[model samples]
Target: MLTVSNLYVQYGERILLDRISFMVGDRERIGLVGRNGAGKSTLLKIIAGAQSPDEGIITRPGSSTLGFLHQEMNLPKGKTVLEETLTAFEETNKLEERLEVVHREVATRTDFESDGYMNLLTEMSDLEHRFHLLGGGNKQVEAEKVLKGLGFKDADFQRLTDEFSGGWQMRIELAKMLLQKPDFLLLDEPTNHLDIESIIWLEGFLETCESSVIVISHDKMFLDNVTKRTVEIELGKVYDYKASYSGYIEMREERREKMAAAYSNQQKVVVQMERTIKRFMAKATKTSMAQSMQKRLNKIDRIELDDEDTAVMNIRFPVPPRAGQVVIDVRNLTKKYGGLTVLSGVDFKMDRGDRVAFVGQNGQGKTTLARILVHQLPPTAGEMKPGHNVHIGYYAQNQAATLQPNLTLLETMELHSPPEMRTRLRSILGAFLFSGEDHDKKVSVLSGGERARLALACLLLKPINLLVLDEPTNHLDMLSK
Candidate 1:
């Protein structure tokens, strides 16, 4: 069990967490919910001891250990997926090593009745038992179970960790966390990189996993399936609910309505008090009442309602100008990296107004073809040509990363926007939930979702016939998606 009391965290003039307090019970499944930048991830980092709050006390038993998995991870080079995963049992492996030493010494000694020899037997037995309890003997099995559960096949177990993309790399980290089985687990946006099947698998794993968990996720069904309690952070305040995510949502609305009423009533009372004070202040006979009312008004701390984050994305691809019947024509298309062939000789054609979808396992030619169509990647053999008057707008999977980090979000939009469209930049940003102060934020400081939104916003600035989008919704919130 862990307890956080009177926690406060602030960044410059903006407050992130304001005197928030909550307790995580033993084996409790906690869902930390809040809008982007509401400090949900901040609280998790504090609990995991990776971050220190500006003011607060986090009390936990000395024996309790913490495991943290965040959005970004550092992968080890030259290590296979299974090897990397097995490192989670570091402590248990150390115990096994000590046990081996003790066994060797005992076998070499002749004084069986000596205290030192007898003590070696006790130590060896204790170490072996501890190692067994930590699943040391079955580390491979445990690691394999978690890897497979996270959507990794047996063949992938031998692949180098660095060989996979970011999403696949995330699975490797999650597997390590599950393998550790720490006393407490803190996961931030754990399902951001997971597919639906992996999410379901993780939900089942957490349901039976003994460790207490606190996860910050936007997946409604995922939270509903895995969590037993919910902690919401709104307007720098904490609302604790002993219910699932769906139940918490219903109760949160009721609480919000009641708070709205209280705020309304307080505003009316303050207005009435001000008028009464003004009316009585001009009369000397009523000076005492006027002065008392002035003091009351000055001391009052007016209630503030929670501000809703309801920024909607105003995104639509511009209609391309009239083009020839054939939009794109590909002949003998083939792509190869060294000796490996990704896409063998193939022929494809797309007419104007045609909508096509590419579906296949990862590492296939889906993204490769998308890039080839956009002229970002060249085919190893053959050629692809767009019809006359055809214009293309491409949104790559990692398009956000291509943004200039030194530029402000506003500046990035301005650069892509033409003179005639510059006036509409603010409105366009507001649609993507970036407005007011957000426009001034540097691209380096934007979250993954924010960057993705910015990238998509830029895509809508130009008119094009062929819109090639690759995993455009990967980083977006559930509502945005």
Candidate 2:
């Protein structure tokens, strides 16, 4: 069992966690969720011993190993897929090596009844038992199995790690972590770069893993499929719900309603008491009653509801004149760099107001196709034509670079909007929850969700009938999704 008590974490003046506590029993799967900057990742790091909290105690059983998969860990290059994964069994491999050395020494001995021969035999037997216990002989097979389950083909196993993309490198890291098979596993956004098929395979592997696993992710379907419990971190505290994602939502709603009702009843009592105190005080003959009311008021505890805000993109496309049915058309579109083909022989069409979702695994030409459709990347062997009155408003997935870092929220809108639309800049900013000082804050200081909302806000300044958003909801919360 792993347990945390009085976990208080703070960054400078901001308190990220306040007296949080939780436990994970053996073989339990828990999902950690919250809004952006709600300390989900921080909590994972603290548990993994990568960060130290100001005040807390994390207790785990003795001899229990922990495997943590962080997002920003370095991977050694110049190693094949099999070699990288086999590194996880370093101790087991060393044990097997020692066993071989003992066997060789025993075989080279002349006297079979010698004390040294007996000692070697006994030591070899113990080493053999330990090797078998550690699954040393089958280590290579286990490593291959995990790598394949994570979507690496058998032919690709011999390839060098440097040949794969960043996302594939992340998968290698994941495979190494899985091979460790620690008593507890801490995974942060494990499915970020996975395709649908790979996600399904990983979910199955995690479901059968005989260890306590805690994962932080934005994928609701993944959480519901893999986790048996949901641990939500909100407002510097933790709430434990003994159910899946869907069940947790229902229970949270019920709990909110109950709290709202209780607060309403308390407000009514406070109002009635104040009214009675006013009526009696006006008489000038009920001084004791007024004093009693004052005491009660002083003793009453004000109820404050949870101030939970959901991250959402308030996107309103600027309406343009109605266009023809066909907005975009591509014929035999093909894109290639040298001999490598990113996309080839792809035929697609987008009509006006078509909200098609491009679903595929990472690095499967989804973004490449989006770029082609927007005319940002020229196709080598095909043509794209826009129909009459067709206009395109594209939102790039990497909005951080596309947006001006030096510009404030209001300034960004002013730069993109027409002069006549400038009058409504305050209202527009308010709609995106950027009122007050937030409007004056620079885009560089904004969080990922904030940046996404600002980018969508910038899109509203133009008059375009067609909108193409690539991974618009990548860093958004549940409400945003």
Candidate 3:
């Protein structure tokens, strides 16, 4: 079991976590959830030993191990996908090599009564046992199995890791983490880079895996499928429920309702006490009685309802200028890099005001098509024509990463916005849940979800009728998604 006691975390004046305490039972699957900037990722980093808490202690068995997969990871460039994943079994590989050495020593020694010969034989036996227990014989098969489960193909296994995009590299990292099979798994936004089928595969994989998992994901269905418990962080406090995401949502609502009711009742009592105190104060003979009552009222602990943000983003695209009926037309579109063809003779048309979605597994050219639509890439052959007066607002998968790290949130938005938008910038940010001191926060300090929201907020400053979003909801919370 993993236990967190009196955990405290603070950034500047904001108390991200306030003396929170929780426990993860053996083999438990927990869904760590909260809105953007609620410190869900921070908590995961703390548990993974990547970050330190301001105050608190985490206790677990000395032999227990942890594997963490976060958004940002630097993968070795020269290694192939399979080879990189097999690095998880480095200890096993070393043990196997040592076992071979000891086996050879035992075979060559002819002195049956010598202590050295007998010791060599015993060492080989122990090494063999350790290697078998670590699944040394099946390391390659295990690596392939995990890679395939995460949407990798058998053909792609031999491809260089650096040849793939960031999303594919992230999958490689996840495969390594899964292969390690640590006692505790801390995954932050694990579904962000996964396709629908891969997400399903991962759900089944986690359900059967022996490792206890604490996953932070915005995908509600994924959480519901994989997690057995939900831990929510809100207003620097935590609410734990022995239920999945769907059940936790219902239980949280019930808790909020109870808090509201108690707050209402307390308000009534507070009002009554104030009224009685005022009446007694009006009489000179009862001044002492009023003072006593006022002291009692001051000592009363006021009930507070849980504060939840229910604000909805109101987004309206700008009217498209007069244009031809055909918003976009493509014929025999083909794209190739070297000998590999990502898109082959793709043909499609979109009329004005029509919405279309390109869905496929990673590396299947979904993003390539989006980029092509926005004129970001040139097709090797065929044609893509846009209607007259067509204006496009594109949000790339790496839009948040493209933001200037040194600029404050408001400044970043101001740079992208038109002069007319400047007047309503705060309101626009408010719609996207950035307000008050949030505007002053530097982009570098924002979490993935917050940066995504800020990036999206910038796009809305001057929208076009044709809005092309690639993996737009990857980093957003459920409400924002």
Clashes of each: 1, 0, 0
Ranking by TM-score: 3, 1, 2
Residue-level lDDT of model 3, residues 1-481, one tens digit each, is 9998999998777889999999998899999999888999888888888889999988889978899998778898899999899998987878888987877777787898989887887888887876775568899998898899899999999999999888889999999888777889999999888888899999998998888999999888999999989999988999999999999999998988999899999999999999999999999999999999999999999887767766656675555566668999999999998898999999999998798988877888989889999999999998999887788989998899899999998899899999977888888888788777788989988889989988888997785778899989999888877
Model 1 agreement with the true structure over 307-410: per-residue lDDT tens digits: 87655576766556988999999999999977779999879999988999987655677888999999989999998999999888898877887899999988
> Model 3, clash count?
0
TM-score of each: 0.80, 0.76, 0.88
- In order, candidate lDDTs are 0.85, 0.82, 0.88
Question: Which residues of candidate 3, in runs, are more than 4 Å off?
Answer: 94-134, 270-302, 316-320
Error of 3 at 457 (Å): 1.8
**Higher-lDDT candidate of 1 and 3:** 3
For all predictions, the C-alpha RMSD in Å is 4.7, 5.5, 3.9
The most accurate candidate by TM-score is 3
Looking at candidate 2, the ten consecutive residues that score lowest on lDDT are 309-318
Task: Tell me, by lDDT, which candidate is best.
Answer: 3
Q: In candidate 1, which residue ranges exceed 4 Å CA deviation?
A: 98-130, 261-304, 316-320, 323-325, 329-365, 378-385, 404-406, 414-431
Cα lDDT, model 2, residue 461: 79
Compared with the true structure, what per-residue lDDT tens digits does model 2 show for residues 1-481?
9999999987555577999998899899999988765788788888989889999989998878898986555789999988988898887878878887887888789889889888888888887876775567899888888888888988888989998866688899998888777889999878866778889989998988877999988899999999989999887989899998888999889988988998999999999999888888888789788989979987999886876656454656566879899988889988896777988888888887677888876667887788887789989898888888877778876653477889988899898889878898888887776757678778875655667777788887778887777777665667766
| Candidate 1 clashes between residue pairs 3 or more apart in a chain or in different chains | 312-431
